[model samples]
Target chain A: MNLRIKLIPYERLKREDAKKLVKDLKEGTIILVDAKLDPKEEADLIEETMKVVSTKFSGIELSSMELSELKETTNFERFKNMVIERIMGKKRGLTIIGPAKIIRKIEKNPEELLLYM
Target chain B: MVVKHFRRLKNRLASAIRKVFKKKKEIKIGLYGPVNSGKTTLANRICVDWLGEELGKVTSIPHETREIQMKEKVTIKDNGRSLTFNLVDTPGIATKIDFEDFLKFGMKRKEAKERAKEATRGVIESIKWLDKMDMVLVVLDSTRSPINQVNITILGNLDARNIPLLIVSNKVDLKSSSTSRVRTAFPGYDVIGISAKTGAMVNELYKMVLKKI
Candidate 1:
């Protein structure tokens, strides 16, 4: 019953950012990441995060979404332009990371993604 | 690499081990887990499959099974061989059994208290009967977190006694279910997810059971 979520713009993700993420994950926080923020470096950061928490139980589930789909729902997110710019900038979806000990499972639905946001 | 090598060695030696346990015509397979995790449901599935009868009643209420239930001489048909077993369905184990918890479900306080005491005794008996188990199925709800201490303690005790075991992650029929989480939690153990109520992936479980023992 412990449902937790966090939204992070992966485009701005840094090595230090990854370190903090490792800490939050240990606390059982499910982090949602956007790859557009730092497209070139998110994967490496995730890899780094994996290595940091590798000895512990963990998992990741990713789901993709179109920026247009998100925009249609909220009538225009104040951050829609940023998301669109980022999607155009090559960020395509959301990546969820959490302690597998708690996160357990995930279901993908882009439309429902806003609720978590 | 070490785990891989150990598994290879274990597989190489499984037949020899099987020969020893196989001599006892009725291998005792214990069904154990926390309350409402579906141990009885799986037990019923196995019993019905081999004996044409359900093992016991299954309900949504916790600790409904306050005593050990048994079904004997269930012969399982594997690849080309038949294996018989005495399926032992035990009461759920809990660190704390509070009558108040049962009272929340609308049971009278007096009955709830009595049930709690019986459940606590059942837990003790289940632990004592561990020695009777030739092998055990640690059934768990796949939709829930696998970090509970009850199962961990049971697993540790089983490890100490060198009892062979397989984790049955039940209720994979739920949308929120994920065997992968159980897999990650017990990286070294074989964990299988199945919906015992619907009999999904049960054949896979049967094959794994044959391989495990």
Candidate 2:
């Protein structure tokens, strides 16, 4: 299953920096995230980010939220509770739900997240 | 002042005599092609040269000529018999694109894809009008990549209908133009490569059009 690692603070990253990260991420690479990114300030950034991301990951399946741009933002406790319910014993690719830096968590212990989610 | 006045009167008398003897058939020519084929530029050229000196605004954006445009004039060579003709410039045929939904402040991905598909369908609908045309001028942009599904569909339809097709490969002045490639793309098809910007081969185009008529 596809999981998104949404980068929060999208406005902080330059276009070139985003490109490099996206290139390195490779297609179908999973991001295991802990929280959702700020939506209002980074909405356009998400689209621009996705364009670059798609160039690298054409046809790759996408699942879950990296940043919740949904009409209603899911609270942190509720999000975690829902993720626990959805991911328990599920073997799926992980994605970060917040800022680009959130990727660091996945980089550190991807295998652990894989075992859990 | 008297001599000048007489000259004006004499010119008017000559025109009146010419009008009495003119005989020419009005030809309705339609400029058609896949989207981004530069039909508008060619249409504008014909309008300026044959219909009037003033050209309407020309744009490079696809589907700029979304509706049919008509221009008329009397062919001078054939006396005053008016060679009035209508030029139908239709919308470009393209893959689906949905801007309307995307422009909405908060739209869904499903909605956006639907919009693109709708835009594409509109193009196909516009192309169906080709059946009513007397002659078609197929414009092709020489700078773009090789022709794909869109060009194939247009050519196949025109061939099936037995419509006289004049393939115009426009924008030849561009350095990256693929005139020869365009010819190879549609083998055995009569293709004319012309720089619409410089008016090159426009006269040749007129002659070809005249012969077809």
Question: Considering every candidate listed, which one attains the maximal DockQ?
Answer: 1
The numbered model that scores best in TM-score is: 1
Scored against the true structure, residue B64 in model 2 reaches a CA lDDT of 47
Candidate 1 has an lDDT of 0.69
- Candidate 1: which pairs clash? A11-A37, A11-A38
Q: In terms of docking quality, how is candidate 1 classified?
A: incorrect
Model 2 chain B: worst 10 consecutive residues (lDDT sum) = B74-83
Model 1 ranges with Cα > 4 A deviation: A1-117, B1-18
What would the per-residue lDDT of candidate 1 be over residues B72-175, giving only the tens digit for each residue?
Answer: 88888877966678899999865445566787889997888777667766776677788778788999999988854456556656654567788999999999
Tell me the lDDT of model 1 at B81.
68
- Tens digits of per-residue lDDT for model 2 on B105-164? 355666544444444444544565666665677888889754543455566565555556
lDDT of 2 by residue, A1-117 (tens): 455543533233322354444444453344333332222112222333334322113211112232222324457744665576466422122234222222222121212221223
Residue B213 displacement in candidate 1 (angstroms): 1.7
Which consecutive 10 residues in model 1 chain B have the weakest lDDT in total?
Answer: B1-10
lDDT of 1 by residue, A1-117 (tens): 676788876555443455677677767687777642232233333344434332243323223343533525453552575567656564455555556566444443435432222
List interface RMSDs for the candidates, in order: 17.8, 17.3
Q: For each model in turn, which proportion of the native inter-chain contacts is also found?
A: 0.00, 0.00
